[model samples]
Target: MTELLWYGLIINERTVVNMKKKYFLLALLLLVLVFSLTGCVPGDGANNEEHLAGFFWGIWHGWIAPISLIIGIFKDNIRIYEINNIGWWYDLGFYIAVISGFGGLSLSRRRKK
Candidate 1:
């Protein structure tokens, strides 16, 4: 009877651990879905200015690449562009942020033991 009880407790602990892992994965997946959807919409460019603005805002919040570059130049860290256009740099930064996030997530998941 004692052996059976010990086995049951061990099984229950493992079940709880598995449940926690499942919930963690579910949350991570939801986060990824939210991030991906924030930038993607179904419509032509002509009718999607609002969506594009929201997408760019999201990119700025996540990456802040343009801001980093500006700060770098101000602090004499790098001299890639003397006159950077906000629109072009923002767009490029947004693309880099999205691709890097997706790739990083994929690589991390793939490397899990």
Candidate 2:
């Protein structure tokens, strides 16, 4: 009787473990699909736009840089920095947003008294 009970417990544990693995795989697949689709967005070198990306675009890109980096890893054309940008102003805005976005998170952390 004890042997049967032990066997049942072991099977239950294995089932639970398999379920967890399946869930993990499902989540991973979803993440890959999302990033892969996002990677397809217009990017790389320069597009046919009449106007290049400016300071606002730089800020937007900088904000989503981390996501772009992940997408870039999977897709060849995705880039973190915009190639079609207005020189110094774009760079300045990118830096500002990047610094503030990341740095602000650190600054906003509450310290325990």
Candidate 3:
């Protein structure tokens, strides 16, 4: 682009749009490559082992579950509950987290006019 300006060549709007599309595609390709290279789950038999990640961890992770879901799309071993859990307790924490995180907004008190 600078070279074009230096050469006194006019850049068209179509050219700018094409450049943006190329950059978007490049970034998407890079992300796919990166996510494909990493296995998010640990190799210590996480599928069979349940180490009780506990309530606090469950709450924290659940708060960020949407992010984990996106990452899980590329990795095979990663999951919301597969990373060591205390079964229903973890679920309880997750439910609590999700409810508090989103439901609290809906439950907000309104001031009387």
Best by TM-score: 2
Per residue, candidate 3 scores C-alpha lDDT tens digits across 39-61 of 33322243345455667756766
Over 4 Å off in model 1, which ranges? Answer: 1-11, 41-113
Q: Over the full model, what C-alpha lDDT does candidate 3 score relative to the true structure?
A: 0.65
Instruction: Please identify which of the two predictions, 1 or 2, would achieve the higher lDDT against the true structure.
Output: 2
Q: What is the lDDT of residue 8 in candidate 1?
A: 48
Best by lDDT: 2
Candidate 3 ranges beyond 4 A from true positions: 1-50, 109-113
For residues 54-106, write the lDDT of model 1, one tens digit per residue.
Answer: 44543543354444445455555332222222456545656767667656778
lDDT of 1: 0.49
| Candidate 3: pairs in clash | none
Residue by residue across 65-89, what tens digits does model 2's lDDT show?
Answer: 8878887889887888888777899
